[model samples]
Target: MTATRAIVVMGVSGSGKTSVADGLAAALGTAFIEGDSLHPAGNVEKMSRGVPLTDEDRWPWLDTIGQALAGSLDAGKSVVVSCSALKKIYRDRLRQSAGGALTFVFLKGSRDLLTARMAARHGHFMPASLLDSQLATLEDPSGEAGVVTVGIDAAVETIVARALDGLKTVG
Candidate 1:
């Protein structure tokens, strides 16, 4: 039998985390969490103005996301959540919330592909201009425990299948 995963779908701003996580959640029969919703107003404001966030700006937001994940896990619910999770320290902090229960799915993609996707997106506060900042901040999670890396070039269905297969293999 396959195990249920409380996963964080992590990547740069335009790496299709939302599309992939939503598909995976449906396939896995779990809750779909939009981690951007947990971001504080100040953080959103900063991003909307094309400003990069300092670590100080993210602590409260990460804490809030961690709390939500912890709450869902403690309630025995499995969820697929979307977060940039651009740094190892950020992932480490979230690990404190649920220990080994959290798996991070890294949506790896080329900058050109991601930037085009971001440019084509509508109504998101994160502008395509900030893609560089996000890419710069991202720390590869290939060596991290409980991490599944899936390329974002494929269709959403393919990405979901690959990620689920990766989870099974890693587990």
Candidate 2:
């Protein structure tokens, strides 16, 4: 069985990445980082203005998340990260920078669910209007390396439990 050094919870906005990653980290008795917080001020500003981030805009943020993942592995602590890693390129870059030390748990759901979730949110820089762009940009993680795809809309406990189950399978 291969040991997992890090787990990345990925999905578009409002797919519950944060909640699931937090729960998974707690369950694994390790640290969890919110990938969004690592985003540069410029990226936040762009998203706040309803502008979708280009590949160039996201490189630094992705690298930052990857570094965090690598650091956790170096510390010998399991880690979980909440990130909207919507593209294969993004995931590949993250894995590369993580030094081949990460697993991905992708939360997938209907656009309607994500849109509703985005709309109900408050005090967020990402506007609901940007959801279409986000969805469009999203490339499902199917056939990607070291990835587990989990259905969205399940209870948080159920979601976390399934993630743990997946880890056992992978390990």
Model 1 lDDT per residue over 1-171, tens place: 256558999999989889999998998889998999889898999999999998999999888888888888888888888999999999999889766678999999999999899989899999988989988898999879889999999888999999989988664
On residues 13-121, what C-alpha lDDT tens digit does candidate 2 reach at each position?
Answer: 8888999999998888778899999999999999999899999999999999999988878877678899999999999898888887778998988998888888887
Residue 103, candidate 2: C-alpha displacement in angstroms: 0.4
Residue pairs in clash, model 2 = none
Cα lDDT, all candidates:
0.89, 0.87
Off by more than 4 A, model 2: 1-4
- The number of residue pairs in model 1 that clash at the backbone is 0
* Candidate 2 displacement at residue 141 in angstroms: 0.4
TM-score of each: 0.96, 0.94
Range of the 10 consecutive residues with the lowest summed lDDT in candidate 1: 1-10
User: What clash pairs does model 1 have?
Assistant: none
lDDT of 2: 0.87
